[model samples]
Target: MQSSSKKETIDCFENAIKNLNNVRTLYTENFVNWKGVTKDSKEYYTEIIAEELINKINNENIISENIKPLERENYKVPSRGKTFISNTNRKEENVAKRIDKMECGELGHILYYQMPLKPNNKIKKVGKIDLVSFKKDENIVYVIELKVANKNETLLRAILEIITYYQQLNQTNFINSFKDDLGDKYKKVEIQPAVLLTCDCRAYEEVEQLDERPYLKELIKKLDVELFSLSLNIQSIE
Candidate 1:
């Protein structure tokens, strides 16, 4: 007969397996549902849940040997100092982090976030790319900027920032540096700039009505920049 503790361990393992399968099913169904909805029409809640599910799975400790089990008496929360930043900047950073964590399929890989850009050998830091990702199969690289604002001016700023990053990345030295970081696999990828925004439904609806819409679209086309938006009310999974 097995000991009580051993029996409990086995039971836990079985339960975990069942939960994993259930989550897998949920992810598959949700992904299919997401595909059916047009990009603009997709709800923030749906995207949040789908992303949370992926994060949950990735957070699971699959390699038991790599993680040491702690005794109840030994477990304690670590102390950390509170870091402060403006609310607006925090939101922008949070959105960028979310995009960084997302899985981009087998061919896609996130290259870096907050990648520095120093133009023309200038000592001052000009700007940083919010997120950069590469798709190996397509030989394409994405330079993304995350914006928490719905304002047209903010949108334009993000577009300019990404364009600057793109230009810096296209430089020979910068390309060589990236090659060193990502290896030779990304040697010949085409870079594309993009702006990602988090806005409420009303703001999103008003975007098309903005006077800058035509000029924005023209600039996007001219610069080969992609525009993407997500709803602002994405809830955190507890």
Candidate 2:
């Protein structure tokens, strides 16, 4: 790659990393200069924004980071889940705990929940991956972000989180942490990012399309991530 081209790709990645969390509108709004849009031009302008983001996300030049000196919670659920998990996330943790205890069934066995990533801020608040698992007979590790029914998060936002975390996981550290659990085949198992959605979640609803392909679905297909609509039988404590 030319020096200029490589630099451009890095810039694209850094920009997306900063704007990812703030993205809410799927088609119309974007990180690019888009505030001046008019109603008539909204549809046309949206396509431009979508196409631009599509190019950025679909670009194969983005760099993936491996945070050396990586860490995990082993396979055990952390006690901080009770206090570290805020009331808002306590509800989410309820689901995380249930998934941790129950058999993965078609989803596969849980390796761990709340996988940590490098924190960008100085205060050192790290983001946690919802769940990580492996299939019974497959050489693939699933890094999953879960959204339960009626979650208010936009589909695009959830997609970004999984993609970012998948890129940030250190392969050597993750597998070696459970070397005894995976055996020699651990070297061959690849990390696959996934979104596990409970039926009727906002993320689930947004991806449902027949007349035309949803941009989010197209992006997921282009990025090669997995999507699963799972049915969990846990009764809500809310």
Candidate 3:
């Protein structure tokens, strides 16, 4: 459904976020009834409503040119930090390290761990990406967002966040940072958006089920975002 006004568009996104907590369990059972309806009273399937909201938000989203790169010392592929910015997401750190270790022929040889994105001088920091993998041989760059097996975040939330992050990145500034710091190998990389889910997570399992849903397939086709599931060797991140 095309949003007739900007407020309607914002309403769609705000509504989805408000209902985000229910998506993992109640998505298939709910519907996005008209605006102002209580969350409990909405009456429609999630994919149908979410598909519209996602398309709306994604179509309107654009990469802000304000993103600036840090100094050469900060662009290190194998990050020095062992913990996330929050210092609590050990599982994410573990996954990033594991991906960083893989051969370039595999998931990507060079990885950027918890890379901080600076939106502008005023904000200083916008957000930190989970990981960015560069495969030199194929000249492909994967902008990845990682979620561990125990994470309970919903599939829709993953879709929304990865899309937002991928779009928010300043491609021109980011590419310049890579070329100036990492060398010519990154000059022609093909950037792709991705979401990495630990094999047993709710989002992973939920995504597998989404494969048969046309709305989801359509959504993926529209976004061009890839979904991957990794089976971690360790028993638990705990």
Candidate 4:
């Protein structure tokens, strides 16, 4: 049987994940330009919701005791049709900071960084990765792909998607692609590509299966891509 502390921890984490999802949904739904707002004045409401989640996490004493209140210190009301790119950046930075603060063998230790995925054409299939990293010294960045389950198939898809990104944004090809727009400066920016996977799902158990894929192995051989499955277990204090 699960201990009361364990159960409370699971519940707290579940609630946190739900709130995170809500934040992402609101951000995606109202996303427009760089401001991250909706024309219908929904940005204020979304900000309010995010504030509430943060407050609940910060002020609550016990997992199932007093009700949690919403806090607004950490978030801002976005402008209509504006994108949540800034928030995403904040999230990634926070993830990195959290990893930096941890001891060895801590959960959620991996950090992710910016990974852009643009298709050959205009139609976009997946969103751009915000950030991913595996210890600054490890020299591995995960191109995070969040999902619930069935990681074997998901990891395969992630591998292909990252390869496409590699083919588009690498040193040799990008310089020419941006030559007309960037002129001489295009060659000046030195950018190394890193690919990885990030999710809150318990799929790390299947990590070995992912490393064995033929196409995945080939892609890794050429591009140095990596795979990381993230799982967060937050305990609620009483």
- In TM-score terms, candidate 1 sits at 0.49
lDDT string, candidate 1, 12-85, tens digits: 33454455433222212322122122233333222233233234435763222122221122111124244233
Per-candidate local distance difference test: 0.47, 0.57, 0.57, 0.35
lDDT of 1 at 105: 52
Which candidate number maximizes TM-score?
A: 2
lDDT per residue for candidate 4 within 80-161, as digits (tens), equals 2422233332443344334432432312233323334333336334345444323333422233433333333333334334
Using Cα atoms with residue i matched to residue i, what is each candidate's TM-score against the true structure? 0.49, 0.68, 0.65, 0.33
Task: Give candidate 1 misplaced runs (Cα > 4 Å).
Answer: 1-89, 104-108, 119-122, 149-152, 180-184, 201-207, 210-212, 231-238
Q: In candidate 4, where is summed lDDT lowest over 10 consecutive residues?
A: 68-77
Write the residue-wise lDDT of candidate 2 on 71-143 in tens digits: 4424333464542323463555567766663557666887677766643335243467888788758877788
Global fold similarity of model 2 (TM-score): 0.68
Q: What is the C-alpha RMSD of each candidate to the true structure, in Å?
A: 22.9, 8.1, 8.0, 19.7
